[model samples]
Target chain A: MNSHLILRTVSKFLIPLIVVYGLYVHFHGDFGPGGGFQAGVIVAAAVVLYALIFGLDACKVAVPPSWIRIGMTTGVLLYVGTGVVTWLLGGAFLDYDVLRNNPDHPAGQHLGIILVELGVLFTVATVMVAIFYAFGSRTPDISDEDW
Target chain B: MLNLINAAAAQAGNVPPTLIIDICLMAMLVVVAFAIVRIRSLFAIVMLQGVYSLLSAAWFVSLDAVDVAFTESAVGAGISTVLMLSAMLLTDRKSAPVPVKKALGPLMVCVLAGAAMFYAIPDMPAFGDPDSPANTGPGMEYMTASVKQVEVPNVVTAVLASYRGYDTMAETVVIFMAGLGVLLLLGLNGNAGFWQAKVQGQNICTQAAPRARILTSPSDKPNTEPRAPGDPEPSSKNTSVKKVAAKKTAARKTAAKKPATKRTTSKKAAKKPAKPKGEAS
Candidate 1:
C-alpha cells in the first residue's frame, strides 16, 4: 500500500492505543510519571493524526471546528466548576475537606480528577485539530501572478 | 584548586532526576530556539518552531508542571504554528532570516527576569522536598480534607475550580469576552457580505490556477473556468496571454465596426483607373 494508506491504517490502530495509554496515565498519575495534562495531550495527538490523513473538510465533518472550540471552553469550565462546587459547600474555594468534612474519603478527589481530566482532554484534542486545519489550509506563495 | 575541590565535595548531595532533566531540557531549548531563529527557509522555521515548543513542553513536564506543558505543546506547537504558517502562505518565501539587530534591550530584560525568578526560587521549597511548607500548608490540609467533604482525589482540580472559584469565574468571563471579540472581528453574521466578495475573488483565482497544472502556461487551456476571476492567478505566462488576448479581441471588434473608412479608400482607388492605365502605357 502507499504511504498515505499505510499511515491512515496505522493511525486507526494507534489512536486507540494512545487514548488507552492516556487514561492509564491519568488514573495512575499519583504513582507514575503521567497525569491529566499528559493524558489529554496524548488523546489530542490521536485526533490530530486523524486530521492529518483526512483533509481539513473531512476532519471538520467528523469534528466541527466550532465544536472543538466549544470543547476547549467546556474543559476550562468543567475545571472551574469543580472548584465552585466545593466553594458552595462552605469550604474555602477548593478546600475539599470542607466539601463534606470527611478527610478520609477518596471519592471527592476521584470525582474532581476525572472531571478535570475530561476537560483537559476536550480542550487539548479540539485545539490540536484546529491547529492542524489552520496549517493544512495554508495557501502556498508559489503562484507569482500577483507579483 | 584545593578550595574548589572542597566546595565540590560539599555540594555532592543527591539531586532529584527532575532537576537534572530540567537543566538538560533548558540547554536543549536554547539550542532549538537558536536554530529556529537562525533558519532561513520559512518551512524549516515552522518545523523548528514546533520543535522549540515541544522542547519547552518537555521542560515543563520535567518540572512536573503538567498543565503548562499541555498548553504549550498543544497550543504553541500545534495551533499557533499553523496560524503563523497560514499567514506566511499569503506572503513571500525565501526571505532572509529575520535579523536580531536590537539584542541589547531584550538581553537585559531577560537577564533581569531570570535573576528575579532565580531569587524567588530560594524562598520557595527546594525542589519537591515533601517536608516543604507547600506540602504541609493549608493547600495540603485542604486536599486531605477534600477527600472527606468533596469526595475528590485531584487536589489540583479542587484548588483550581473551588478554592479559586472567583478566579475561575473571572477567567471564564474573560474567555467569553475574548470569544465575543473574535466573533465581532471575523463573524459571518455581519461580515458575510464583505467576505463573500473576497471569497468570489479567491475562487476565481483558484479555478484559474489548476492545481494539477500550476507550473505550466495557462494559454494551453483557455476554456477552463476560473476559480476566482477578481483574484490574480499566480502563474506568470497565462495571465499575460489572457490580458493580451482580451485587448486584441476588443481591438478587433472595434476595427470591424468601422468598415466604412476602409470602403471609402477602396472606392477612391477604383476611381483612379488612369493610374493603372498610365502604368500599362
Candidate 2:
C-alpha cells in the first residue's frame, strides 16, 4: 500500500471531502434528504476508505478501538437519557414537548430531534467502525494463491 | 419519421423522461442480479451487490424517497461493501459449487416466495394514491402539522425523531445491541497482538509473553530478530520498536525510583498479556 503513491495521494485528497459531506448531511438533515443513519454510514465509509488505502493498524491508531467501543455505548445512553430527561420533566417517555418550559413548543421538538439524531450518528458510526476493526484485525487464513 | 417521433414525444410530455430512467435502472439492476448469480467469485458478487444498491438508490430518488435513497447509497452501497470485503479477507474468495440437486429446494422456495409476492401485488393500492391508507393516515397529519409542531422542514425526521421517538429509540437500541454482540464475540481477540502471534506461527504463550516483554524490553537491545516470513519490510516497524523500547526504559527507571510505581507497572504488565494468552489458540 505504501508503494502505491497514486492511491495514497488520491485518498488523502478525497477523505476530507467525504468527511465534510457526511457532517453536512448530518446537520442539514432537518432540511435535506440525509439524516443521522445515512450521514453516519457516509462518515464510516470515509474511515473505511482510509483503512483500505492505508492499513487497518493505521486506521485503528487514528480512531482507537477502545474509543469506538465507548462511543457505541455512549450513543445508546444518550438516546435513552433524552427519554429519561423528558420523563423527569413531567411528560411521558420520549415526549419532546415537555423538554421546554412551554408545553407544545417547537423549540423543544427541535432540540430533542437534534439530540436524538446526534445519538443515532454516534452509534451508527462507531458500530460500523467497530465491525470494521473486528474484521480487519483478524489474520486471513487463506492467501492470494488460494483464491 | 422525425415528425411522428416529435408528435409522440409531445404527447408523452414529462412521463417519458422518468419512465426512461426507471426502465434503464431496472434493466441494469436485473443485469447485475444475473451477473451475481452467474459469477462464482465472491469478490465480484460483493461488487455487483454494491452496484445493485446504487441502482436501487437511483430508483428511490426518482420516486422522491430521497432519504431512503441516501441511506441505500451510503449503507447498502458503501459500508456493507467494505464490511463484506473485510469479511471476505477471512474466507475463501471462491464460493463452493452447489450441486443442482442440493440447490433445487432453495430455488423452489425462492420461486414460490417471488410468485406469492407477485400474486399479492395487484391487491395493493396504487402508488401515491391520496385515498391509500398510508397517505391518508398519520402520514397526512405529519405532513400537515410537522413543520409547525416540530419546526423541522424534513417531515420524515420530525416524525422519526419526535412523534415516533420511541420506535426510533428502539431501533437505536437494536443497533447498539448488535454492536455489543459483535464486540462480545470478536473484540477480545481482534487486536494486533493476536494476529501478530497467528502470523508468526508461535504458540500463544510465547507470542503473548514477547509482546509484554517488547513493551517492557530494555531500550538498549535493538530488535535484531529476523523479520517473520512473508511480513513486509517497512520503516514504521523500526520507529515503533524504538518508541516501545523508549517507553519501557522510562517505565523501568520510574519503577526503580518508586517501589509503589513498580507494583502497579508489574501488575499492568502481568494483566495485559494474560487476557490475550487465555483466549489465543
Candidate 3:
C-alpha cells in the first residue's frame, strides 16, 4: 500500500484534513451540531482510514495501542475528576455552576462543559480505536478462496 | 433567476422540499433494509448497513437533529463500517444457511415489538408541539434557560455535558466497558504481537530480531526437511503455499525493501491445521 502512489498520495492529503475537521467539530461543538461523540468517531475514522491505506503495522507505530488504552482510562478519569472537583467546591455532583467562585456565573459552566466534552472525546475516540485494533489483530478463520 | 426560483419555492409551500427529501431518504432506507435482509453475503450486508446509517443520518438532519445526525454519520456510517470490515476479516464472509423454523421465533418477537411500538405512537404528542409534555415542563425550562445558564449556543451539548452530565458520564463508562470487554475477549495483541510476528518476522515478547530473521529465511525457501507422517494432506500444503505466495507478492509490491523472510513464519503457522481451528472455535 505504501508503494501505491495514488492511494498513498490521496490518503496523505486527506488524513490531515479529516483530523483537522474532527478537531474543528470538537471545538465548535458548543456553537454548532457536532460535539465529543461525533468528533471522536470522526477522528477514529481518520485513523482507521490511515490504517487501511498504510497497513495496521504502520498505524500501530504511529498511534500505539497501549497509548489508546491509557487514553480510554484517562478520559473517564477526567470526567469523574471534574465531578469530584465540583463536589470539593461544595456543590452537588456534576454541578458546574459552583465550579468557580461565583455560583451564578456562566463562565464556570462553560469551563465545565468544555472539560466534560473533552473527556467524552478522548474516551470515545480511544475506545473506538481499541475496538478496531482488537478486530484487526485476529487472523481470519477462513481463507479468501473459501469466501 | 434567483428571484423566480425563490418565488417558485415559496409557492410550493413549506412542506415540499422537506417532504421530498424525507420521502426519498426513507424510501431508500426501506430498500436498503430489504436488500440487507435478502442478502446472503455478510460483506454486502455490512455495506448496506453503512448505507442505512447514512440514510438515517440524512433523515436526522432533516428533522433538525444536527448533533444526532453528526453522531450517526460518524459513528454509524464511518466507524461501524470499518469495525465491521475488520471483524469480517477474522470471520466468514458468507452467512450460514438458516432454517425457516429457527428464524420464525425471532421474526415473531420483532413483529410483536413493532406492534407494541406502533400501538404507543398515537398516544405520543405530535412532533415539536410547544404544548406537548416534552416541549413543556423541564424541557421548555432547559430551552429557555440553557442559553443564559450554560452560555453555549448548542443546547444539546450543554444539556448532554452539563445538565444531564451524569447520564453522559455513565454512557462514557459504558463505551469504556465495551472496549474493555473486547480487549479481554480478544487479548491485547494489536501491536507487533503473535499475528504480526507471523507476517513480519519480529518476535513480539522477546524482541529476538536475529533469531526471527534466521527462522523466517529458512521457512521461506522450500523446506527440504522430511515431513512427519502425521502431517495433513498435500492439498492443504498447496493452499498454504499459494496463500504465502500471494502474501509475498503483495509485500513485494508494497514494501520492496522488506525482507522476504517475513511471511514464511505465517505460512508455517497456517500449516498447523489444528491450532487455527481450535482458536477460531
lDDT of 1 at B18: 54
Candidate 2 lDDT tens digits, B1-281: 64665566678885445666677789999999999988999999999999999999999999899999999989899988988987776666789886666688889999999999999999899767889899988779889888778889998888888888889889998998888888776662252232223446754422332222234332222333545779875556677677666765564454445532123334233222222222222
Model 1 residue B143 distance off true place after TM-score fit, in angstroms: 4.1
| lDDT value, residue B106 of candidate 3 | 88
Q: On a 0 to 1 DockQ scale, where is model 3?
A: 0.45
What candidate 1 gets wrong by more than 4 Å, as runs, is: A1-5, A19-44, A64-147, B1-20, B66-95, B98-125, B129-138, B169-281
**Candidate order by TM-score, highest to lowest?**
2, 3, 1
The residue-by-residue lDDT of candidate 3 on B19-137, one tens digit each, is 66677789999999999988999989999999999999999998998888888889888988888887776557789876566688889999999999999999988767878987778
Cand. 2 Cα-lDDT: 0.74
Q: What's the true lDDT of residue B202 in model 2?
A: 56
User: Interface RMSD of the predictions, in order shown?
Assistant: 18.6, 7.7, 7.0
The per-candidate TM-score of the B chain, in the order shown, comes to 0.55, 0.62, 0.61
Question: What are the candidates' individual DockQ scores?
Answer: 0.14, 0.42, 0.45
> Ten-residue segment with the worst summed lDDT in candidate 2 chain B?
B272-281
Alpha-carbon lDDT, every model: 0.55, 0.74, 0.74
Error of 3 at A70 (Å): 1.6
Q: Let me know the DockQ for model 1.
A: 0.14
List the per-model TM-score of the A chain. Answer: 0.77, 0.89, 0.89
